[model samples]
Target: MPLAGLFAGALGAAIAPFALRLRGPYLAIVSLGLVYIGIYAARNLPALTGGLNGTVVTAPVAIGPVDFAALQVGPFLLTREQGMFILCWGILALVLC
Candidate 1:
């Protein structure tokens, strides 16, 4: 997923030089269409995205010596959230780097 985002960003960067050639409504329409298509693709790929029902992601790390599934944190205790946060931040850092 992180790699895919990186590729997309690279593609966008490559296209940026040409984007300036487009003007006004033409540029807006093209950009909006791309956004719509990306959203549509994500929604349709059930195995990849799990659609509106959402998807299950396992823990990125165990909570100390305990099993991550058995661990609790505050009221909304879940390993998935921690995993996602780590995943997102890791990707963000990769992008920044």
Candidate 2:
């Protein structure tokens, strides 16, 4: 659920004070170690993460009237890849602006 993301965000905020203490290569090493730990957890925790094979994430594809699962612009209907491309770039452009 989206609440999980909020929890993660709160966890990160709480951990920032400790994580920000490290500098230079220490920070890099810690970040890399966290990545490895996540990978290891995902691989070992099959029930939670679906293991190394990964799992399908079927989240909602619509926001209001815009349905990304079947995105249409004018007369053209976009494929999933095309929709994703547009969505990603749109986000990027919005951030940049």
Candidate 3:
């Protein structure tokens, strides 16, 4: 899905050469209109995006062979907080990569 968005953005950039012939204010208006449309779509499509309240996300389970449920570090046992920490760091690593 991210790759598809990247491709779509590239296609938009490729088409910008034609749009560049337009006046600066016209281009800005078009861009702002598109942004408004995107925001409207996101708000109206509740079934797809969960509306303004947002959506619930399940935490991931384990890190490689080490089961998160079984992990115990010092006095702290692995629970929801640790699981969330692992999940967040994993996502961060993926984004950085």
Candidate 4:
């Protein structure tokens, strides 16, 4: 799921058109209002945004033959947390480069 990147790109594109029509404090207030509205919706909409308590994730962590759920390499074995920690930082490093 390209969820994070997708939302970020879409938000940029969505705001760009409006940005041309807004300026200074007017734009700032509008942006702040939108953020407050978004937060309110997340809090009130139970099914949509998990009602602020948040949602449980049950996604598997895997990359080709490397399954993070039960990762083992020669003499090294890693737990789910350890595997995901490596994967996340590794991806961050790759993106930074």
Q: In TM-score terms, which candidate is top?
A: 2
Ranking by lDDT: 4, 2, 3, 1
lDDT of 4 at 20: 68
Q: What does candidate 1's lDDT look like per residue over 1-97, in tens digits?
A: 9998997999799878878799999899879987987789788986876676865655345545744444465675666556556556766999999
lDDT of each: 0.73, 0.82, 0.76, 0.84
Model 1 lDDT at residue 50: 65
Could you give me the TM-score of model 3 versus the true structure?
Answer: 0.41
What is the per-residue lDDT of model 3 for residues 1-97, given as tens digits with 9 covering 90 to 100? 9986996699689858977888889988877876787689779998965678865656556678866655677887887667667777878999999
Candidate 4 residues 1-97, lDDT tens each?
A: 5996898689879877887698899899988887898889888888966686765667999999889878886799988888888899989999999
Clashing pairs in 3: none
Least lDDT summed over 10 consecutive residues: which range in candidate 3?
54-63
For model 2, name the residue pairs that clash.
none
Candidate structures ordered by TM-score, highest first: 2, 4, 1, 3
> Global lDDT for candidate 4?
0.84
lDDT of 2 at 5: 90
Best-fitting candidate, scored by lDDT:
4
Return model 3's CA RMSD, one decimal: 5.9
